[model samples]
Target: MNQRYTGTAIFLHWLIAVGLIGVFALGFYMQDLPLSPDKLKLYSWHKWAGVTLLVLIVARLAWRLSHRAPELPLTMGPITRMAAHAGHWLLYGLMLAIPLSGWLMSSAQGFQVVWFGVLPLPDLVAKDAALGALLKTTHVTLNYTLLVAVIGHVGAALQHHFIQKDAVLSHMLPFAGKA
Candidate 1:
């Protein structure tokens, strides 16, 4: 049996990872910018990226649900295995939650999300300043949570690859070379 993720899975994983990083960075950078056309453009791009991420993550989750992921390495301890499982689900949850929260915040702020300046996405919530504040907090909290989780994930992968000398990380590498 193949131990590695399928090519499509690998592609989606990397694509989303890169997109998340970009969106996160853009979100932070744009927040402090004085009100201007440039900031508005950045916000639009940020919304577009978030929507794109939402679509990709939904597809990724659907694929994951239908297909089994490789089993944990035999060498992994019980605690490590449990943490790995929980961490993965947490990542997936954050992946969905962050964007949903953002969508809600936008809707509450009475903003329309136009993806890539093309497709228009419907609001997830009604416009209300109070609701927008709450959702904004939720979105920021979730982003921070995601950032921490990603750090832990990277650390675990590095541990598996360098310290444990295991296939845990290599199995997910894009150019793993020779099944």
Candidate 2:
């Protein structure tokens, strides 16, 4: 099996990484702004970006199911393999859940999600202040969860590249050599 992911997979991985980082930064910084038009504008960008991530993750998951991913190195320990699998699944779960929660929260607040000035996403729940508040809380909570997972993911990648001197990190890079 190839040790490096396909070009499409590599592209998607980096694209999502850059996008998610931008979204996270926007999310964090936007909250500090006073209630004003600028803050609302920032939130608009954040919301669209989150929706984009949701779409990309769904597509990535579909592609993954159809194609075999690059294999781990033969010398990788069982614990490492387990950790890798668990981390990936956790990332996948969070990626899907966070955007969904955001959408639901917005819908509950009676706002339609406009996807990058394109189609409007339908609401998943009825309008209710209490429910909206709950969803908002859930969204914020999941954001923190996502932050931690992302930090762990990045830390592990750096560890593999620097400490283990393994191709685990390189495999996700577009220029990585084939197995």
Candidate 3:
């Protein structure tokens, strides 16, 4: 069996990774900008990226369900294995929750999500300023939480590569080989 992720899996992973970084940066940068055409345009782009990521994540989940990921190294302890699994699932959950929360917040704020400035997405909730404010907080909190989780995840992967001296990180990286 192949030690690395399938091409499609690797592609989707990197695509989503880059998308997340871009959208997250855009979101933060645009948030504090005074209301203007540029701000509105950035919001639309951010929303579009988020929607695209939602679709990509769903596809990723489907692919993951149908295919088995490589087994964890035998040297890792049961507790460590369980923690790794939990961290992965947590990432997936955040991936899903963040987009839905943003959509809901948009709806609650009386804004419709126009995907790529063309397709009109249905509002997830009725307009309510109170709920919109709360969802805004929820979305931001979830984003920071994901940021922290991602940092830890990357740290763990590096730990495997540098400290554990294992193939754990390379297996997920396209064109990567053990050092």
Overall lDDT per candidate, in order of appearance: 0.92, 0.87, 0.93
Model 1 score (lDDT): 0.92
TM-score of 3: 0.97
User: Which ten contiguous residues of candidate 1 have the minimum total lDDT?
Assistant: 170-179
Give the per-residue lDDT digits (tens) of candidate 3, residues 1-179: 55777778888888888999998999999999999999999999999999999999999988888888777888999999999999989999999999999999999999999999999999999999999999999999999999999999999999999999998888789788632
Worst 10 residues of 2 by lDDT: 170-179
lDDT ranking of the models: 3, 1, 2
| Local accuracy of candidate 1 as per-residue lDDT tens digits, 26-139 | 999999999999999999999999989999999999988887888778888899899999999999999999989998999999998888998888988889999999999999
Q: Residue by residue across 1-179, what tens digits does model 2's lDDT show?
A: 66777777778878888998999899889988999988988888999999999999998878777778778877789998998899899999999999999999989998888888688888899998899999989988998998899999999989889988878888887776664
Residue pairs with backbone overlap in model 2: none
Per-candidate TM-scores read: 0.96, 0.93, 0.97
